[model samples]
Target: MVIFKPKRRVCKGKEVRFEITELDPFIWLQVNSESHVSYSIDGFIIDSQKKINGIFNKYEYELGTTLDVLFETLTQTFSQEIYACASFASILNTEYRIFIWPKDFPENFNIQDKLIISIKPVIKDKSIDLSSYKLVNMSALESGIKKLRGYSFSNVKSLLSANSNVECFLANNTGNPWPGDLDALIYLKSENKTIALIEFKTHNKNTPISDEYIGKYGKQDWRRFEVLYNLQNQLELAQNHKPKIFYVVWGTKDFDNHKMIKIDIISNNKVESTNYLDRPAFGESSMELFNLLLKLC
Candidate 1:
């Protein structure tokens, strides 16, 4: 919610410093790598730790367990040897702390002091206060990851150019928590310099509009609608760029007027939905899917 000015740290062409402090149940680190590595580490668990002999240790937490879930996310996000880690061992005890100095850093890993890394304040409950955190780590919500429906907002930008020659991607790292992402942002490389904001959805099955689909009291389709509304607002609030368009891209088993009729009712005619039967999994089919997105744009 706040943009702190970058404090320039002269690395002097040398390795910069980063640290992960022991904050009990959660580990906190400042992102000072500037535009290069700071954004990459935003929602990552350092992935592994280095032994004194410089060997990387793999996480052996039980599969599908909470620890395993966190580690799996780390594997997907980064391939670096940042040595930033969140281990069950640390949660069980208070001994492990991360302090990255130049001599101890990975070779050829560039570091800069100009980057501003904001550390979130720890709550008494030992859980992260998502609002206080600058970066929105979808992995932080182990269960909610499924709610993303295996969609990647990044590919919208990447695929469009390859398929349709229109440039698009995440506007900027808002650092907002889960459900606080700008689903799709596209750039039209014309003289006007226009951008588009898109909301994408994918469902296994299309349930009819009723209490089963639109209730706050229990499992309902309205929950997804609510998240879309929040993401829309987040994009509008954070984006200062002008000449923007809003769109909704849906991939579902059933794409009929009956299903969308209810969606329009819930969206209050504020959003537009484009339905497709061949919805690709997250990070896949950037070429074809984004080609369709270009038409919608």
Candidate 2:
């Protein structure tokens, strides 16, 4: 009789179970896995510069490897958190291509605001600074505000990046936009060509109340649409861009319940959706996914 047992690989346990792909080709990815890089999870990958740049590392497997094998392999060897070239990655690697996403993903700023950053693949031990990640929900939108504010650039980017497959070396299909020339534009980050259209409504106190608000429930609803149309045209934003028009609605209560209801109807009617941000003190409402948004922002 003969007895034989399998051999275990480095960093992995005794069961040569889950297999990992060889990460030799994507030279850019190697730096992130380096020994020097130190990191922790702040929603997503935050590099040495305190920036969120989406990145992933993939390992290809041979014929013998099974999901069970991969699953078992992943259970061993440790490095719980660190700043790296990708998001939510493990022994997982897709067979085909993946798009390349833009480097900088915004922190606590709304997707509808005038804030943008282009970060590269950087890894460091230190953490980020995010005191300005603000989102004040004036109406019944406290939850929404917190969700929005909680997101730092890294968290926002990581959530999206982690879901997509990483074998093809592809860019983000639903790429994030940067604030456009007018207000803001979250551009689709891919080698494949595409257009972007973004709008930001800076609610400075001085800016007069839009007619849209006053005409309906005395909250300028009509004026906002006009601005939206104008903004869409100026940017040459295609219908697909889903041209968004944000109402920062800053300062003291500029909108009442009746006004909000009217605006809500208008927004629902439009192809591109619209949302509001209000403070809890005024409305006595909880923040919607706003904190979550901020965490990932």
Candidate 3:
């Protein structure tokens, strides 16, 4: 009996280094943990340079779609004109095409772009040759928005403390919505304005923006932008309510290498703060969230 040999693929089951074909038309490109995986866009690129306009790479998704599936876990938002949005939107829209180089790169590596890729790890680049790589799809976006991608709780505390008001709140009563066990909620408060809600997320096991957060908070509609859906409900409870800012604080143990993300929401053209708290996990970067509550509270 003759046995047939299996053909080997180029990027088989490994993290493949790649770049976008162009910075325009398509503003953002990301990498995944494994090679040969379809990469996706979490948020569209902003094109800070205004090189190619017409909302390149910034397409809206259907609410229940898989790309938003990760955000559904949020069960998180509130009153404020400042809508929560993907902090990376600006980065994604950058003019500079970004790419992932192998963890090991020669110091002589040179890269630059009119626009910058805000969140980058060991790998960095400017000229992304998309013709050589594949388009990043949904799964890749999830990997890019990894739990460790945001700012640390402590760093968020410091940044906002210096630039904004803050409130350290714990449930006076039991059964707090936030996981008080982690003391994870850091409310940025200034007088009546509730600046934002910061949650420190650092476990190696990343949480889905939709699934994890909703599950984290009793599986309510915690989808990041989906929280805007609750605004009417919250406003009906009162009135004159606006969107709240939210940040998923991420860290790596030491206070360095922190990233804060503006949780995406639908409404208002700006970013505001949120109302939340949680316990700290080691190796977390400060997640920067915004909200209009800061003006009120």
Highest TM-score against the true fold, candidate? 1
Question: Clashes in candidate 1: how many?
Answer: 7
> Sorted by lDDT, highest first, which candidate order results?
1, 2, 3
List per-prediction Cα lDDT, in the order shown. 0.26, 0.25, 0.23
Quality of model 3 by C-alpha lDDT? 0.23
Those runs of model 1 whose alpha carbons end farther than 4 Å from true positions after fitting are: 1-220, 241-283
TM-score of every candidate relative to the true structure: 0.27, 0.21, 0.20
Over 1-297, each residue of candidate 3 has an lDDT whose tens digit, in order, gives 011111112221223233211111100111111211111221222122312111111122222233133123211211111111211122223221222221111112222211111212111131112232233432243233332222113222111110000011111111111111111111222212212223233322233222223234443434433333332234223323332433343322232232221232223323333333232332333221112222322
Native-to-model Cα distance after best TM-score fit, residue 219 in candidate 1, in Å: 11
Query: Which wins on lDDT, candidate 1 or candidate 2?
Result: 1
lDDT digits (tens) for residues 80-156 of candidate 1: 22222122112112112111112211123233231111222222342322123222221232222222223334422
Compute the lDDT for candidate 2: 0.25
Point out where model 2 deviates above 4 Å. Answer: 1-183, 191-227, 233-240, 252-297
In angstroms, the error of model 2 at 259 is 17
